[model samples]
Target: MKTLRKYLSAEGLIKSIYSKFKKIQDPKNRTGKISLTDCLMSCFAIFSLKGLLQAEE
Candidate 1:
């Protein structure tokens, strides 16, 4: 959400990156491998949420 925007200048940055990776000739994308979206979301989750959780521990 909005929190991710701090790390990414804009939403288009994420989309453009995803699109570029999608066009690669790698077999992973064609098969059952993870997509660019998953990686991006994971990173976003970590960056946005980890700091808050660590403080509670």
Candidate 2:
């Protein structure tokens, strides 16, 4: 079974980000299909990919 232990790896960093994002309260007046955390993580993923692409150039 997989454990919930935090590690000093990339997976640990992602888990940390997700946990922190969950603490942020949603501010939208109307509810959307996606959750706030999912939106924030999507943005983060985009930026991360952009950085990687730039570094490859």
Candidate 3:
């Protein structure tokens, strides 16, 4: 249980999660100003914020 608590914390997992996001393949035909990893991370951030907001209610 103690081990689970340590790794499961959002602070601890963020870097690992972001690294995984960077590995995803980009399907865009041409490279744009923004990178695919950034886009995915942005969506992840939005979803995380939404979850936090719902938890507060």
Number of the predicted model whose TM-score against the real structure is largest: 2
Which portions of model 3 show Cα errors greater than 4 Å? 1-6, 51-57
For residue 50, model 3's alpha carbon misses the true position, in angstroms, by: 3.6
Better of 2 and 3 by lDDT: 2
Residues 1-57 of candidate 1 have per-residue lDDT tens digits of 245553457566656666665565654544457665566655654666667557657
Better of 1 and 2 by lDDT: 2
Model 2: per-residue Cα lDDT over 1-57, one tens digit each: 876548776678888999999999987744878899999888777677677557657
Backbone clashes in model 1, listed as residue pairs: none
Candidate 1 has a TM-score of 0.36
lDDT leaderboard ranking: 2, 3, 1
The model with the greater lDDT, 1 or 3, is 3
lDDT of 1 at 17: 60
Best by lDDT: 2
Model 2 TM-score? 0.68
- lDDT of each model, Cα atoms only? 0.60, 0.81, 0.75
